[model samples]
Target: VVDRLNLQAIVPSAQTLQEQSSRMHLKKLKTVVTYWATRQIITYNVPPLAFIIAANTNVNTGALINLYSDLQKVAIEDLFNKS
Candidate 1:
């Protein structure tokens, strides 16, 4: 089962970017992330922590790692059941 959303669809293709140019690809990805964040699609604390973790990366590396572990707390069945 697809327990988690496919992030690749949302983020620019890493492989494609590498083929073109790593620097350009990274810039594109950063731009996309900045755009998404500025749009306020993923606001702070309004959505679940899971959603915040998925969208934002300004958090510290250790915090991010902890948040990722929280993903395991979400059952696969719950993910499938979400509308």
Candidate 2:
């Protein structure tokens, strides 16, 4: 991991990294994008959360984390049966 970090730092800049990322082979692109989207919480885990999200705007991040936790608290019955 340390070696990877060192090599990553050697990349010239953000622009260079963006260019290099295209060339880099990914074993699991979904895993990479999942992390980029914060374990998919900020993307699709909770539908309400996904609907209202806005970028480049200031808001309390803690509330989002708590909200995600609250939504994740599903009962077993909620999981097993549906209409």
Mark the 10 consecutive residues where model 1 has the least summed lDDT.
38-47
Candidate 1, residues 6-49: lDDT per residue as tens digits?
65554444454345444435433312122233121221221143
Off by over 4 Å in 2: 1-41, 44-52, 74-77, 80-83
lDDT of candidate 1 vs native?
0.37
Clashing pairs in 2: none
| Cα distance off (Å), candidate 2, residue 25 | 16
lDDT of 2 by residue, 1-82 (tens): 6455553333244344344445555322311111121222222234322212322224444554455445544422354555
TM-score of each: 0.29, 0.29
Q: Candidate 1: misplaced stretches above 4 Å?
A: 1-10, 14-58, 76-83
Q: What are the lDDT figures for the candidates, one per model?
A: 0.37, 0.34
